[model samples]
Target: MRQLKIAVVMLLIGGLLTTAAFFLAFYTAEVQRFGTVTLSEEIDSAYPLVGVSNEGLQYERPWFSQKIFYFHVPVAEASFLVLILSAFFGVRFLTTRRKEYDTKSRIAMETALTFVALTMITGVLWTKASWGVWWDWEPRLTTYFIMMLLMVAYFVLRNSIEDEERRAVYAAAFAVIAAIDAPISFFITRLIPSQHPVVFKSGFATSNLLPFILAQVGMLMIGYAIYVMRMSEERMRERLEVAKEALED
Candidate 1:
């Protein structure tokens, strides 16, 4: 009951912060020119030329498509963070063989799945806006796709097992292994050539950074609220099951 109240409070606060961030990103934040193009070939006469460089190259200011970053980045980061949390609980479950830890791990995985799905939705839109494509098999995208598959597989593995303890063990082990891909996906752009922008490497202007931070913090709070609410529901269901079994006996 207390947890439910706290979850409601967090949901309200998180919703307000996320809404404020969205408005600020669209209005108050300065539109950033993410990439500048230097024309090597014969430049089109209709191109919006910013200026000419010292080497006599035409510099064209590209269209602003970075607005999606405010949402996309925070969701992506939250997904990985939740995945790690799931894995942490998974590890604890393995060491202690406790049902509560397994429950927490499962709930965290569910939250991660939610964040991952949102990341994919926003990522697809960002990809279309930036790369002019709906999908691409780049390193980051491919690895994240695989992570989502692994998350799905975790639940499948859980449901397939009839023994509760065995099911928990297998799911916990799988989650730990799946978490190994998170860092790989995160650093893929730095390790190899990729079209994805490295937001942290270049840094951000004050106007851009504010909304980004708000979105990130708000998203995490919402994610936690979701986890808490789900856990509460699960506990109620467990109690009902116990009562039903007692009455039947």
Candidate 2:
């Protein structure tokens, strides 16, 4: 109970911090200009929104997609981090063959998937706002989309198997493989020419870092809160199952 109280507190704190970050992004953070066309590009080129001007200043970049950074980035990072957590638990379950660890792994994966879904939704919004399109078959986006499918497949595979031990083992094995996509999703652009902006290639503006950090920490806290809550719920369900079995006996 005390732990659950702590989880609740954590959730509230996370929500507050994320909200604060969202507001700060618009008010205090330095607005960033994303692109300036190279000298090779004609000064009188058709793409006027990007390129250096005669006055020697970068063209005004849009901030509409930038606002999504606070929300989308945090959630996306949280998803990847939680996906690692789930994979770690999956490893633990395989070594231990313990139901408790399996339950933890399953719950963690579910939480990861929830965050991934949020990431995808926010990503699409960023896509529309920034790229002016609904969807694209780009490498980075495709990588995550495949990652989500693999996660869903892991559960479906678990459901198909009848034996408890076998199900846990198979799910654990699949989860580790699924996590490969997590890193792939992150670094996909580095390996190839891609449209996704590489934020770290140059670095973030000093003013942008604070809210970004705040949002990241908040998202991590929220992810933990969710994992803890799900573990509690799974425990309760286990207890109910035991009671049912006892009644039948």
Candidate 3:
């Protein structure tokens, strides 16, 4: 009962924060000028690099799209954090053979999958608007793509196994490897050069900071709420199973 009450309070807080973040992002944050390009009929003329031109060829992004960054970055960060949690619980389950750890791992992974999907969708849109491409093999993007694939593989492995214990063991092993692989992918992606221009440099303006921070805190709270709710459901199911087993005996 206490846990349930705590979960309910968290859900309410998370909902409020999320709503506040949404309004902040939409209403605040300075409009960022991405870059400039010439629209002249000189088809082969070299264009001046961004931030170097004195001409008025540059244009600022739509306020709505710029605001998307606040939400997108937070969700992306939360997804990675949740993936790490999934791997941690996976390791715990393998070492202790505890059903509770498995339950936690599974729920964390599910939450991660949900966030990852959102990250991918928002990332693609950001890419399109910023890079003029629907997709690019950029470092951050590529690492996330691989992360998403590893998540799918984790579920595939779980579905293939028949025995509960064996499934838990196999999934745990894969989770560890996947967790390790995610950082490696990130490193390799950053190491490689790409045409995509990096935005959101260090030392963001005060206008941008508020929305970004609010979005991040809100997303994290929501992620925690989702995890707790799922965990409660799993616990209830486990309790029901125990009750059924005792009755059968």
Encode model 1's per-residue lDDT on 114-192: one tens digit a residue. Answer: 9999999999998998888999999999999999999999999999999999999999999998888899999999999
Query: How high is the CA lDDT of each candidate model?
Result: 0.90, 0.85, 0.78
User: Which of the two, 2 or 3, has more lDDT?
Assistant: 2
Rank the models by lDDT, top first: 1, 2, 3
Error of 3 at 217 (Å): 0.9
**In candidate 1, what residue range of length 10 has the lowest lDDT sum?**
54-63
Q: List residue ranges in candidate 3 displaced over 4 A.
A: 37-64, 185-191, 194-200
Q: Model 3, 184-229: lDDT tens per residue?
A: 6545634677553344533588877887787788788889888988
1-249 per-residue lDDT for model 2 (tens digits):
677888899999999999888888988888765555345334543335453566563544545577887888889889898888888989999888888888888899999999999999999998887888989999989998999999999889989999999999999888899998999999998889889877679688777888888899999999999999988888888899999999999
**Each prediction's TM-score versus the true structure:** 0.89, 0.88, 0.84
Number of backbone-clashing residue pairs for each candidate, in the order shown: 0, 0, 0
RMSD of 1: 3.9
User: Mind sharing the TM-score for model 2?
Assistant: 0.88
The segments of candidate 1 whose C-alpha lies over 4 angstroms from its true place after superposition are: 34-48, 51-62
> Compared to the true structure, candidate 3 yields what TM-score?
0.84
Pairs of residues at least 3 apart in sequence or in different chains that clash in candidate 1: none
Per-residue error at 233 for model 2, in Å? Answer: 0.4
* Residue 93, model 1, lDDT: 96
